[model samples]
Target: MKKKMMVGGLLPALVLSTCGLAGAQPVAMDTLTAMEQNPDAGSQMRASTEPVTQESLQEMRRQLEEQLQQAQELQNRLNAQLGSLEKRMKKVEKKSWEPPVEIHGYGRLRWDKHRYEDRNDPNDYKTIWLNLFTKYRINDRWALHSEHEFENNLTTNHGAYEGQGGYNEPGGKKYSRPVLQLYAEGRVGEVNVKAGRYYLQSPYKFTFDDKIDGWQISYGIPTKWGRKANFTLSAGNTYSKIFYGDKENESNYWNEGGDGNLKVVSLIGEIPVAKNTNLAMHYGKIKRRNDRLERKTWSIGFDTKINRDLKFWAGIAKSDSQTLNKSHFLQLQYKEARPDIPGSYDIYIKKYLQRGHSGMTNWFNDDIAEFTHGDYKEENIANNGNDKVFQYSRWGEFNGLRIGVDFVPTRNTKLLINYTFGKMGKCLDKDPGRRYDYSFFRTQWEMYF
Candidate 1:
């Protein structure tokens, strides 16, 4: 019986292999038929008992296809993530304040009192002064600025007696307070271009501090000393003959109608000298600007700082003068404005000379000119129709010296005191003249923010 059962189980496997009817794995069909007759067959069923049907095969194929699709989707997601990470790693960043705008201004207020020695004249007087300025920076290379000045007690009552009615008070008219500067500037390449009415503080600050009406071009190279070596070429109106101390007190050079002779040219330079110091040089020319003044002016000057607290300035210039005659000026200054100190101070001394037709040009200089014709020397200080002192505003054949000090109790406040002494020339007429000795005292107070 055992031999017959073994033969019976082997017959179907051999027949299936011969016919090649099974797919991957051959099934024992004869043995399976024999098992159906046994009572224990149900307990020996395999995990995959049925032969593979078309429906089952299709289901298996569908499952494989889904798994392949899922793997492909996962691979594509990894590739996208890698690309995004590479982009983030390769990118850069930038800054915020590429272009900019700004604003700033400074101003001052002052009082002055002056008198003359050895002259029995009504020359002692009181005065007040004020000025304001504004600046606007439009861009990195462009800017604009404006300045205005107001004054009182600029006129004097020369003809009136004590307690009598005369011209004594200030001419406080709207037009009297003139704009000292109004300008616009921009940089193109290495050169800066500026246009409009502006103040001219030439080398030495000795020859002039007048308002100029026109344009300028400048260039500069920076140095180790913090100051720049710069060059400036400018053209504008200069030196208009008028009395700033008289009733008309004319100072405007721009809108007074064009004078063919009013135009002038200037070349100026600032060169580095030492740490916290610089050297300044200037050359300027003024053409004949009026019917009464058919002449020209050419000037030269230099200024330098010796240390952080010491400086010197000087100039020798000629204007409608005799041969070998020239105008001369010299100044020495000491200053200390420390960042850690609230109290700062400056002391300065100056000598001046205006002879041989140097002319009266620097009207808006640091000091005021004499107002009366009777008190002025031949080189007038206030040149109205009356032979006055505009010519001698700074100096003349007469010896002149001035000393001043500026005291600061805080960052925004200052006090100034100045004294001037002058001696008259020997050749001056005796009629409207007082004496050879002249002197005065002036004081000013200023505040700014």
Candidate 2:
């Protein structure tokens, strides 16, 4: 009986110890041994430990479940944050590959009047001009640019009885359908390059508006004074109705049978000589097909700031020609007109003396002597008595004074007034006894967008 009771007690204690070990808290070995030695004591101890163990396990399990749910929630929040960051990174990467584009331009309305000393009639006209410019940045160092122009003369009636058949009549509007300038520009280190149809502004070539189909390369030179200096080389062929005439006309030298082109090669340089001053030089050669006509031109000039609000420029130009081969100019300006600032104003005065051969085309004042008579038409003077015959060729010898004022009355809008007066040079009339005086007045309103 005693052996059987001992065995039974040991078996119960072993089972209880095993069950306790599987729980979060284990039973003590001393308590298990004590329970094994007494049957009644073991039964009482089991009854007492059972309720406490069951409640403690239930509390522990509840805590563990709560901790597990919190851990899972924290993990989900981290994943959501990580996903948001990844999406932002992807958006930034996509933006880096897209190019930027810009578009802007201006509109202008102008009134022009021409008066001659010997003629009773005055030429008056009005015109509208529109320009559109666009730029696209392909990358950090490469870009593309384009400009388009449209022009129309609004003064169609010269006089009620003068008829409607004239150069400024209806259907005489002018425009460049595709583009006035289209070019690719890029920069590599200190070197810059431009190719395709673009504007060329040189001393002896087109001043500002004419376009050439070719290329230009410029280098930024390093100087000891840390000033700005540049050297440029350009080669191109100029084709414009203003200078070359229409294709059907015989004067369209670039398209006709005479070598099919007028070529121009030019070198220009700007050197900083002092503070707020620069010395400029230019050399250009113009060659026609078959070597029919070749002209070598050179110019030297200097631009300086007299004060914070005053500036001056003077230059002399010469060409290798037997007749009419000299030109000089002096300009002084005060202040500057800022288009963005209302009530801003600038005033300037310029004096220029140009010979026919010196500047093949005077871009600034091409129409200074457009209505003057040349010596070849002297026979008409006897019959008309001071009546003038129009000069077909626009480029000729003339000396003139130009005064201008530019004022901005509102943001992005400008008003300009200019007056010019001059006398014909020897190339226009060989007779020193006769005087061909002319005056011009122009007023323009421009709005920028």
Candidate 3:
């Protein structure tokens, strides 16, 4: 019976392959008759009553086992071939395997033209500067970054300082030139160690005037809650030309030990609240040893999405310039549309208030200039024949406001317009050169890739 069953199942394949199926009429009739008697019966019936032989039973078992083994082998081969084809398809399309390394940078050929509306001195000049940046990535785990900046105010013809006295250049003249970024970083485990001259994002403000030449170590990590956190500690001297000491001749850089050394530590954290909303906070302390000047500041900020087309942010900051003094700053921002939209607009407003002296000395005095590496050494820190430490209204006016707008027409192009107003304690008003209300406007464009 078993042999008959085995032979019956194989008959269909044999008939279909070699018998031209149409000529197998007798076999089809036999198959139908056997199926009617036993639904699973074979097309070729053997003598079932012959007392089934052991050899025949063994043969049927062997054939079924062979067919099963063959079917499994064919299945494995097909799976392997399908896998190879999929791999080739992935190779043909980008973004399939590991992500590729990418590097990008941005720069601004800035030109600031001002007309001294309140004339202690009436003058109009255009100052130009160029900033360049570049970066490289070796793989997912390592990267190299650099930025070079050069500035030459062709109208004033001084890069380091707009004034007459500066470090002599090779051409028997003084001029500012390009400066190197001079920093390298490597990642190990979860920490990134960096060494060399680099830019510090201080809590005081975000501008070139506050950037210092220094070496720093920084690390960042994301918490289980998905918040981003960062920490940094750095030590460096103030720039040259700033004054320090009880007398003019004793003046020098802060780290040279005339007054003392300069140091700074900072931390920042950011958390996401919604798809387009976030919260941010920052804290930092700056120490000046030689002149006994110290500063600590902190800020808290939040960004919220009002709708698909609008976003807003607000922040408040407080600062302690020394042990007994305090200052405050507040800012607000609103975006009409994102950079994805042509002619999209952004607006920002800021206010600043200081109750006590903002550094050791208020005005840009010769000593303060030399002490802090004053790039604007001749800006005059003294209160014009007065010992008021700070000009009465300039540093003491306890109040200032700023408003700005950004218009982006494309992904790589932008326009910025801003205005500022404050009371200079001792700066003069136009009529008699007496310090009074102050206001100014600035406009610029930037391109990047």
> Which structure among the candidates has the greatest TM-score?
2
> What local lDDT does model 2 show for residue 231?
92
Q: How high is each candidate's TM-score?
A: 0.58, 0.66, 0.59
lDDT of 2 at 18: 45
lDDT of model 3 at residue 333? 69
What are the per-residue Cα lDDT tens digits for candidate 3 across 266-361?
565566655666777676665556554555566666767777645565655555532223445566667663555677887878776533223322
**Per-candidate RMSD, Å:** 18.2, 14.2, 9.6
Task: Output candidate 3 Cα RMSD.
Answer: 9.6
Q: Compose the digit string of candidate 2's lDDT tens values, residues 1-449.
A: 56556554664455444444434223433443343454466465455443224454345445544544565677699999999999998768757865378789999998989877766898787877889998898887999999988766678633221222343443221222347799999987878999988877774232323567899999977776578689989888764222222122344433211232667777889898888888888887766654446667788898899999999999998877555567788989999999999999999998988665565334234445442222222223444577655432323456789999999999999999999988763332232234468788989999999
For lDDT, candidate 1 versus 3, the one ahead is 1
**Model 3: how far residue 419 lies from native, Å:** 1.2
Q: Give the clash total for candidate 3.
A: 29
lDDT, candidate 1, 222-271, per-residue tens = 88887779999988875344222221222432222223346667788888
Number of the top lDDT candidate = 2
Count clashes in each candidate, considering only residues at least 3 apart in sequence or on different chains: 11, 0, 29
Q: Model 3 compared with the native: what TM-score? A: 0.59
Model 2 residue runs over 4 Å out of place are 1-99, 157-178, 203-209, 224-226, 240-260, 363-395, 426-433
After aligning candidate 2 to the native by TM-score, how far in Å is the CA of 327 from where it should be?
0.8
Question: Which 10-residue window in model 3 sums to the lowest lDDT?
Answer: 365-374
